[model samples]
Every structure is written in structure tokens, then in C-alpha cells.
Target: MKKLFVLFCLTSILISCKKEKTTENNDDTGTSRAHSEWNDFGLKGNVKSTLEYTTEEKKDGGNTSSVRKFENQFSPDIALKFDNKGKLINKISYKENGNVAEDIVYDGKDKMISKRNFTTATEYVETKYTWEGDKNTIIARRFNGSRLLDKEVFQYNNGRLVEHYKYDGNEKQANRTSFSYDDNNRVSEESYFRNKPTMQTRLSIEYDDNGNKTSEIYYDKNFKVISKTNSVYNSYNQMLTSQTFTDNGSLDVELSRTYDDKKRLITKESFEVYDNSKNKEEFEYDQNDNTTVWKVYKNGKLVSETVYKYDFKNNLIYQIVTDGKGNEIYNKQIEYTYDDNNNWIGKKTTVNNIVFYTSRKIEYY
Candidate 1:
């Protein structure tokens, strides 16, 4: 599905901020002191990443598996530049075969300004974003070589996104989506269309007194009911159960959940459509608040189990998946190397002994 460009930009911004920080060199004298002081000074920085893979043969119990081997590693496939506050300003995505795929540039305000997508050695698609009036309204234009493909406009009202309209190259409206909110400032209805004045689908939602969602109804283009879902929540605003109904108002499926005192979900049971079978998922956490065991059951019979092991830093470093009767199906181990700042700079993973490695070069602020 085509995603909204603004959402993509927002996600990029978040990822840029959460990137792990490391040193440019291993020397811990002057270089280490400089990096430590830079953290106090709030300096701008960038990150470079490389990924490599290798295959190995392994025997678990009496079974064996073959792994696909890629001929080359993706060296320095991605480069990202960030501002002082860690907002993404520029991104260059490279193809697996070591070719530039796209270059995304962001404005000083952290809004994506333009993206260049490479189609051929000499051909490309260029998309530009334009903003107006306090940056609440945005227009995006896409071009393939010299030909315009489509244009889209996003509109916001009272700091809430309300509508998005898509137009053809000739500037004719092709599709649009509208959002409506309730008194509690929660989205109450949404409608979408593929062509002007033609409705495709609509969704309406109802909320409880505490502003928790209670029911959601979906409608087809012809205004016929497609499905209805009803949810029941506890006083803490946590969902306890939910039921989905078919167009004829018949129960289609149901789900129930149980949580511990920490509000962590412990068990989830699903009632299949038109079936009495109940599939369940159970979780167990360790002292570090990491899920150590995850089990899945079908019709009250254990089907599979996954165990997780973490390092002293609470970083998940090992995982083992087994079927019922304790037969190992998959195993993975991860190791990490940290920088002076205690940030992971290198990560290596081995799945059934087939190794994959990723290295990051981070400049700290």
C-alpha cells in the first residue's frame, strides 16, 4: 500500500533520533574525550551502516537445513545526516547491488522537501513537497523524467489532519480521504474514495464514557454494512475482550486477554470464526522485564514455544524456537560490541550458525 509521505517523514525523524551513538575510532585518549565533550556540546552528526552475510551448515537433533548464500555484502548501503536535536535532515538509500536508489532531503523545519528515485542509469523520478500557511497545508508533486505523474495535497484543521486529496497530472481530482473527530478529540469516522464523488469505504467508531473505543462499524461503497467490532475495556482503560460480527450481525470471532499487575499482557485467547477452537498465546517475563518465554497453543494443546535470553544490558542476544515435544526448529544468537559511550556499534547474528553482521559508524553530539 502507498503510505502517506508525511508519516514516512515523521517515522524517519523518530528513527534518526533513536539511532545508537558510537565513536569514529577505537582510540580512547583524545578521541574519547572529544566525543564525551561533544555530547555536552550538542553537535550535529551522521551515521553510516554496512551489512554482510555468510552461510554455515548446522545440525539440530537429527534435522539439517540449507541456507541461501548471497554473493556480496552491502557495504555502506545507507547514510543519514541529522541535526543537533537528532532530526533526520538527509537520507540516501542504496540498492542491495550497490547502486543509489533514492535521495531524500528534509527542510530545516524537519519536513521532507524532496526525494529523487532512480529508475534507470540516466532516468529518475523526482518528488517535491511544498508547504503554505504555517506549514499546516502541504502539496506534493511527482514527476517521472519530464512527465508529471500525480499531485497530492494534505490539509489539516485545528492541528489535526482532516483530509488528503490526490490529483492526476492534469490536476483533476482522482481520490481523497476525509477524517472526522468526536467531542473527545478522537477519530469518530473516516471515509475514502478512489474517484471524485464516488465513495469507496467508510468507517464509523463509537466510544465509551472514558473515551475508550467501544465499537467500530465498516461500510462498503454501497453503504452496506461490512463488519462490526465491539470492545470491552476495564476501568484502567485496558481492553479485556472484543468481538467482531459479520454483515448480518452474527458473531464472526472473539478475543480475550489477561494482564498482570504491571499491565503486561500475559495471555491472549482467540475464538476463530464459526469454530469452537480457541488458539492461545502465553507470555512469561524475566526480572529485567524481558519476555523470556512465549508459548502458542491450539485448542488448549501446546503447539510451539520460543525462549529468549538477554545480555547484562538487557539486550536480547539469543532466541530458540521449538515445537511441542521439545524439538528445536530455529535458533539464533546475537553479539554486540559497544563504544565508549556504551552504545552498540557492532551487531552480529547467527541463525543456526549462519552468520549475518551489521556495523554502524555514529558521530555523537
Candidate 2:
């Protein structure tokens, strides 16, 4: 099915705060840290460096019935270096053979300044970013050796991104996007133009008095509505229902969710009008609000269930999945080794009796 909400997706990216930390906490390894301090890397406590690698047992076939062989040695996957404040400074990713695949560098402000991707032993692509005096990025240029490949230029209004333009290697305009904000400082409209000033598509958003997004409308170049989505929120500002309609005003998809008193999602239900299919998911959480059980139902019939087990430190240690008939389909168990700061350094995961190990060498400031 053709997704009619493409414009909404672009608006979201253009409106979000650039410095906001988008990374989720690492609960599986019990590595807990302040979001602001860790930024988007999710590092734990004053970490200076980290090297991660994994090892897997060899098997005759890629199936559970295959004969297991000796386990391979750990192959380096990634290496990261952080500054005294726990901000990532450098990162290197490796290929399966332990060859450097990509190297990325970040500035003091934790903004990525350059990335070099190794395509082969002698060939690479380099991309560089230029910021506008500690504000939004002004330009990004990609190069193949010394030859310019493409570039993007950004314009801002009072620190908010207002326009973005893309150009080909020859400096010819490829496309452009412009944004407008509402009285609340939220992006209320976005327009896209392809190689010309004529808008090809547009998206408009509406918000409630409490700043909750209430609806989004997609429009074509003629400003005719292509699709519309309406949302309902509870007193806590939690979205309770979202429904999308087609150009003809026919319901396309409807999603409803219920949350606990703590604002954690407890149940979600979705229906697709085209296929007449209904699906539901129920969630159970532990005292710490960690998800412990998840059950899926199709057309009101139970289909699958999953259970999660966590350690005393709130690190996920085990998980099992079963079919509706209660037959075990998948099982996994993890054993962790932690450091004095309670950060896990090593972990062994066994899935369906097949073992895989991952190790992390972390240096703290």
C-alpha cells in the first residue's frame, strides 16, 4: 500500500530539536546513565573508550538440528573513544574480516564533522559537515577523493531550520524543502519543491490547546487534500487513538492505545480497513516499568506470547517465546559479567542451545 503520510514524516524530522538525545537507555546490560551526559551514545559512567567484539559457534547448517562445532574467536566489530565528559570523539566500524569499514569523527560539541566510508582497500567516500556558529548545520558536502559528489545547504530563521536545498555534483539544484511554524513555535506546514519554486507537495499540522498534535493533512500541489489523520489524546496528553483516512474520506487504518497510570503503554489495538484485519498487543511491566510480558492476538485469538526475565540490576537476562498452543518456539538466556560500576563487560547468550558471546573492553575516565 502506498503510504500517504510521507509528508508528515519529513515534517517531524525538520521540527525536532537538533541537540535532543534520541537514544534509549541500555537496560539489557544494566548500563544506566543520565541521558544528557551520555547524549545519543548511551554510554555509562565516565567512559573513555570501548571496544566490542563477538564470537559465534560454528554449525554444519544454519538450523537448530545442525551439528555444533568449535566456537570462533571474537572478531572486532567496533571501537569508540570518548572525551572526559563522556562525549564520543571517534568511532571506527569494522567488516567481518576485521577491516575498517567506516571511521567517524565528532567535534567538541558532539556533532559529527566527518565520516569516511571505505568501499575497498583503495577507494573511499568522504562526507564533511559545516555548522553555522554552534547552531544548525549550514552545509554538508560529499566527495569521492577530491571530486565533489553532492552537497546540501540549510537556511535557518532564528535558529530554527527554515529551508533545505540539495544540489548535484555540478551545483545544480536537485530539490528544496521549506517549513513554516505556528504561534506555538511548532512546525505547522512543510512544502517540497523538485528542481523548481513550484511546490510539489505539502503537509499541514494542527495542535490542541495543550500542544498535542491533533491532526495532519497531506496535500498535492493544487492544495487539495490527499489524506488526513486525526488523533485523540487523554488528559495526560497521551495519544489514545489515531485514525487515517484516504483521499475519499474512507477510513484506512485505526490505532488505539491504553496506558497505565504511569503513562506506560499497556495495550494497543490496530485495524486495517482494506484487509479487515484486527490485531492487539498487551504488555505487562515490572515494578521498574520494564516490560516483562507481551502477548499478541489476531482477530481476538491469542497467537503468541513472550516472557522476559531481568536481573537484580534490571538487566534483561532471559526471554522465551511460545505459540498460542503454549509450545515453546524460541528461548534465549544471557549471563553477564559486570565491573565495579555495575556496567556489564561481557555477556554470553544462548539461543535454542546455540551459544554466542559478546565482550566489551571499556576504559573509564
Candidate 3:
């Protein structure tokens, strides 16, 4: 089986903005302030990062297990410039740690072009895409290393995305994905296929009154339900309930949550994934209601636990994890600094005292 690690760090860097806000009160953020201050005062510097991972088995009646750590570092430099339309333009980023991350480019218009990426000692690699379009069609080129592989095409109506066509590494149409949107501009349904949509499976999405994602249901091409998920939320929009169903609409798994007066999540019950089904995960908070530790228990067995440390700004600074044997398996340390302009100018990451990566932000007027 394959696993996807959507690490918070990865998501934060790639996806900066949220599609919805839980409440208007939380909108008094300092993004604009930081941006303005950074612009007026101008900021430039370096930032660095590192990651450490570990896991251990928990034994009944035994202490937490020993923690073993693996670490890696990534560092980069960011420089900012402006285009004719006054839109910010990103130039080259030199990754000091040999990580060739994605680079963003703009045409000073509506299009954004992303460059290709190469790999390391792996058995395979891929280049990137080249696109050309007007108001209706987009053509993309795929490549392997320096060789052209295949092409992908997209057709749209008005500003609504309608269809996607993907080809092989050599430009053969391999798959197509079509999309449908609701009146509120939310993606209501989607279908995917090899060469075209299949009658086997289609997907639908739903949202609640506060605009929070409420559910996703997948149906076979025969219109028979395949799998469905239901979601619940708190005032902060944090997930409170998650229920999964099988084709017969039978509950396959479910989770529920509880929060404190400050709306901070305090505990969760998971009746799935293992035996003794009605296990629970507990979280403890500090005076400020910040989550300090999390614990998972199954049949009175301690399975997992984690502790977090935070800085004055409420930014996470460090994390520690352990198994039932009391072994420290995962430890991560991160720190950030800003200039007078409030621009985050530097970052540091470490795993068990081994520095993995760091980065600096360079700014220009």
C-alpha cells in the first residue's frame, strides 16, 4: 500500500490561503500588516528547515518505547521583484540543500507557468508542462528528463472549469477528468476515466451552511453508492465528526470530537482501525488552551503520544513523540524570525540536534 504524508509544513508552503473562513472575528490577522511593513521597510534574508521522523511499538503495561530519529534538511533563498502590472514576480530560488523545488513564473497576465523537476538515484524522473490557451483551451506538454513525454489538454466554458484530457509520457490521451460546479461556485461533482469518464464511479461534494465541507459521496457508474463520508464541525470549523459508509450505507468507521471553552479540541473517539473498537485519543492543553500533548489509547493500551512546544507568537517550535515503551521516536525542532518589517526572514529545522535544512528570504523594493 502507498501512503501520502500531507505534512503541515508541505501544505503550508504550497497552499497559503484557505478556501473558507470559520468566522469573521479571526480575520483580524496581520498578513496585510506584515506585507505592508515588509514592502515599506523592505526585507531580504535566508530561511532553513529540517525534518525528523520516528515510530515505535507500544506494549501493554510497559513504558513508552525508545525513539529513533531520521532527519533531512532543505534550505532555499527567496527573492521578490515586480512586473509591469505591479504584480509581484518571483525569480530564481537557490536551494542550498540540493532540493530543486518548484519555481513559479507569471506572464503578467492570467497564466502561471511552472517549470519541471528532475530526481535523484531513483529509477525514474519527469520534466514539466508547457501550456498555451486563449479563453477556452489549454494544451500542456509533459516530459521525462529532457525528452518530451506526452500532452494534456483542457477545455473550459466561461470561467468555469469543465474538462481535462491527459496523455501518456508520449502524448497519448490516457485519461480525462470532467468537473461540475454548483450555483455557489462549489465543485458539486466530478468524474474521472481513462480516455473518458467511466460509468463506474462519480464523485459529489457537499457543503454546510457556514460553507464548510460537509460530505463527499462516491457512486459507481451504475449509480450505486460506493463509499460516502460525512463531516461535522465546531465553531472554529474544526472537524468534530467523521463517518464513513460502505455501499450499503452501513457505518464502516466513525470519529467524534470534544472541545474546551476556548473551542480548542480536547479529545476524540475513534471506533475504527483496530480491535476493541471504542478507543479514544486525548489531548491536553495549557493555560492558553494551546494543545500541549496528545495521547491515543486502545483497550486501555497506550498506543501513541506526542508533545508540542510553542513560542510567544503561538508558533509551533518543537514536537516530541513516544511509544508505549517510552522510547522517543520522533523529534522535530523549528524556529522562525522576522525583520522590523514583520517579514519572516529566517527559519531553522533540526532533528535530534542534527541540522537538516535552513532558508533565507531576500526582498527588494
Best-to-worst TM-score order: 2, 1, 3
Model 1 has how many clashing residue pairs? 1
Candidate 3 per-residue lDDT over residues 99-178, each given as its tens digit: 44444454432445544443433222343335545442544444444555666677767677788887776776788888
Candidate 3 clash total?
Answer: 37
Candidate 2 TM-score, true structure as reference: 0.80
TM agreement with the true structure for every prediction: 0.69, 0.80, 0.61
Q: Which of the two, 2 or 3, has more TM-score?
A: 2
Task: Select the stronger candidate by lDDT from 1 and 2.
Answer: 2
- The alpha-carbon lDDT assigned to residue 223 of candidate 1 equals 90
Best by lDDT: 2
Q: Which stretches of candidate 3 lie over 4 Å from their true place?
A: 1-88, 91-102, 106-112, 120-141, 144-146, 182-185, 196-198, 212-215, 234-238, 273-291, 298-300, 313-318, 330-350, 353-364
